[model samples]
Target: MAKEQHKTNAMRTLDATGARYEARFFDCPEALSGVEVARRLGIDEDRVFKTLVTEGRSGAHYVFMIPVACELDLKKAAAAAGEKAVAMVRSRDLLPLTGYVHGGCSPIGMKRLFPTAIDETCDLHERIAFSGGRIGCQIEMAPDDLARVIPLSRADLIVL
Candidate 1:
């Protein structure tokens, strides 16, 4: 089971946005991705977002929101966050920093306000879905609206 905090990143995100959303669960593999989620929910791959935490040489951590089908361009991510280089953080560095596990990380409610990045690809749609601080659940809302709600570094972070 995940945390028992009762409040999760998804809940905080929705609350911050004042957006209505629901949670849907499934018997998922430990490592669930947006691709699998889109299939299960019968939604487009572009509509399912993935939450990832990254870091730079400076040891600054960042939370990035992007679609599974799309890749996070390091250069673009750096540019968006006004940094020089951005890369995936080590597994050991993730849990303590984000206060969440890597597999079920969310872009909201972290212990600290790490920089956040949302792929501009999501802007094409009115609503998009992302992990709900758990393995098998997701939350959906308007992309632009979501950006405004969460503290995010908004830009084109997708290379594909």
Candidate 2:
């Protein structure tokens, strides 16, 4: 599959940050999981990250990133975000706020700015992978950029 772009928050955000990256697209099968995404991109499965939407206290939405191999602990995530608890936000709710579909959502240039968290597990890879405003399309960037550049909250989210 070839990369496709029709203008998205992710592209705008990348341009704004001056992060040099090339967009690559894969088959985007029904199972568009991060693990398959990494393999399609010829990278380690752990190097690929996934964006997730969660509801905090009072129905406030939050963004979080974690590796395909690890799981996001709602308990720890709530503590990290200073919320009572967190649960997966419905895909229906994500499109309205982020202006992107579920699999395509990216942390960069979200429609709104909420407290964002990237699992410390991301540091395990020198170059991390994330969705590029589309299910198949992805961008590769330095892990440090997600921290120093993006300035997102970081936590050791993986139980392992």
- Compare the candidates by TM-score and give the number of the best one: 2
Residue pairs clashing in model 1 are 116-153
Per-candidate local distance difference test? 0.75, 0.78
On lDDT, the leading prediction is: 2
Residue 85 CA error for candidate 2 (Å)?
0.7
Name the 10 consecutive residues with the lowest summed lDDT in model 2: 1-10
Q: How do the residues 68-100 of candidate 1 rate in per-residue lDDT, one tens digit apiece?
A: 888888888888877889889887877788777
Give me the runs in candidate 2 sitting further than 4 Å from their true place: 1-7, 29-31
TM-score, each model?
A: 0.85, 0.88
| Alpha carbon deviation, residue 33, candidate 1 (Å) | 2.6
Alpha carbon deviation, residue 27, candidate 1 (Å): 2.2
The residue-by-residue lDDT of candidate 2 on 33-141, one tens digit each, is 7786777789888878888889887788888898877888888889888899989888788889887787888887777877789898777777888888877778788
